[model samples]
Each structure stands twice: as C-alpha cells, then as structure tokens.
Target: MEVREIALGAGESYELRLTGRGARGYVWTWQVTGNADAVSVSEAAPPPAQTLPGAPLERAYVVRGRSPGGRARIRFAQIRPPYPQEAPYDEFVLEVEVTAATGGP
Candidate 1:
C-alpha cells in the first residue's frame, strides 16, 4: 500500500475507498493516529462476504474535518484473524490537512 495526501476545508468531510481480496480473508481496518478529535473516521459499511473465491471487496471510510489548521494521520491495515506473529499483511497511511473554510463571494 502507498501513502496518500489530501486536503479538506474545516467542517468538511470526505469518503475514502480501499480495496482488498475478500477471498483471501484479508480485510481493511483503520484508525486515526493523531488529531482524533479534529478529524473523525468511521466505516461507511461492512465488507461484503464473498460468494465466490478471488472476489474483490471495497471498504469505505468517512473522514470529517472538525476544525481548521489541523492534521490527521490515519493508518489502514489489512489483516486476518488470530493475529500475525510477524509483520502485518499490508499497511498504509493517509495524511490529511484541514484548512479554514473559504467564504463564497
């Protein structure tokens, strides 16, 4: 996975979509590394249960900018049950910057 950078206005929100192979039993999960209050994250829906093998599943997350002049580092990981003893299956980070909202002319 690769890190992504995005910007949003104060009080605004954005939806992020991530993909994983459901047939492999790997699912995407996320958490806010910093500024949890300034930026909130929640899952839009649960991952689909695959009816066929090698099916792709998409998970969506909603991130909101609560205040201006703040940043939030969100980390997402792909893992299976029983926990891995070594490195995680996959991981990525999303860096978000929240700026002041612009006024319409």
Candidate 2:
C-alpha cells in the first residue's frame, strides 16, 4: 500500500486523485485523527510517561467508494484539513494502495 503525507492548515484544502483497477464496489475513506501521544508501547512502567485522550479533537473528510468488478477512478477536491492544535492533529492519509493483483508471465 502507498501512503501520502500532506500538510495543510485550517480551512485549507487538498485535491486527492485516485485511479486504479480492482473489483468494483470497494469502500474507502479518508480519515483524520488527533493523537497527543501514541500508546505504541504495550507494557507500562510505574511512570507511564504522558497520555492523551481518545477523542478526535477535530475531523472532516469525504470519500467515494469503488464498484466491484470494475475500474475505480475519481477526483476529490472537497477536503478541509483540521487544526487540532491541542492534540497535534497530524493527519495520516493512509489508503489501501493495492488490495490485490493477478499474477502474470
């Protein structure tokens, strides 16, 4: 899968273009979240460093689902990046760049 990191301020927008072949009718979304700190470490010590809440400070997005057994191509230009300053809303534009592919000789 391929992920892209984009930077934008509040009220700003970005255009995301996607074109690929796949079983039509696949659902995809552009999600946004704010995380003060990631609880990546499973274990916890006496002093369990800093912690943040589990609420998405601010979120906004739009998506277009794919159609199964068909091609998927679309252009999205209605996105306004959030500004979760308190939580450092560093957006992560993650998409299933490649779901499946047939072999060739």
Candidate 3:
C-alpha cells in the first residue's frame, strides 16, 4: 500500500488518477474514511477506449474539500469482483487536511 498526504482549502478540489488492467476485469474502487464529511469524492469522466487487449486503463476521480478544519482519508484498491476475499493487486491511500479558505480583497 502507498500513502500520500495533501492539503486543500475549503471548496478546493483535486483530480486523482489510477491505472489498472481494465481489459482483464480489474477495476479500481475507493472509499472515504476518517472525517468523511470533510471531503467529497466523485468519479470523473471515463478514459478513452483502448483497442489493444490487456492494455492498461486509467480512471480519474475528483476529490473536493467540503469543510474547514477537518481531515479525511481516501483509500483505493484495485481488484476483480467475485474475489472479495482475495487481496487487491494494488492499493493507495490519501490523507487530506482541509483548511479554511483565505479572504480576498
């Protein structure tokens, strides 16, 4: 598993991209934990279709800061369905800290 830390202002957002073997039925799934209310996660547009077999696939997600003075953890796993008991081929985690947005003149 890999972990990353990030900081954002309230209402700010970032784009996350993950690669997987979609042609082989592998997909990336994600969940939010720890102060979940502090952030919002949503799937972005799908990647362009791949013509080659067993080609790598990319998926994008948008993570937005929703509340100030809050922290959230986002976990992503790449696995195939019907094998929930099996370990994921890859995993990634994100630790996010959100701060209040600064005022502008």
Best by lDDT: 3
lDDT of 3 by residue, 1-105 (tens): 889999989989989888888888888988999999999999898877655777788889899999999999999999999788889999999999999976779
Off by over 4 Å in 2: 20-23, 35-105
lDDT of each: 0.80, 0.27, 0.90
RMSD of 2: 17.9
Candidate 1 RMSD to the correct structure? 2.2
Root-mean-square deviation (CA) per prediction: 2.2, 17.9, 1.2
Better of 1 and 2 by lDDT: 1
Compare candidates 1 and 3 on TM-score and give the better one: 3
Clashes of 1: 0
- Clashing pairs for predicted structure model 2, backbone only: 23-68, 23-69, 24-67, 24-68, 24-69, 24-70, 25-66, 25-67, 25-68
| Tens digit per residue, CA lDDT, model 2, 1-105 | 344543332222334433311122221223322321210111112222242333222222333222222222222222222422233112234331112233459
The number of clashing residue pairs in model 3 is: 0
Better of 2 and 3 by TM-score: 3
Model 3 scores what on Cα lDDT? 0.90
Candidate 1, which ten residues in sequence have the lowest lDDT sum? 80-89
lDDT minimum window of 10 residues, candidate 2: 36-45
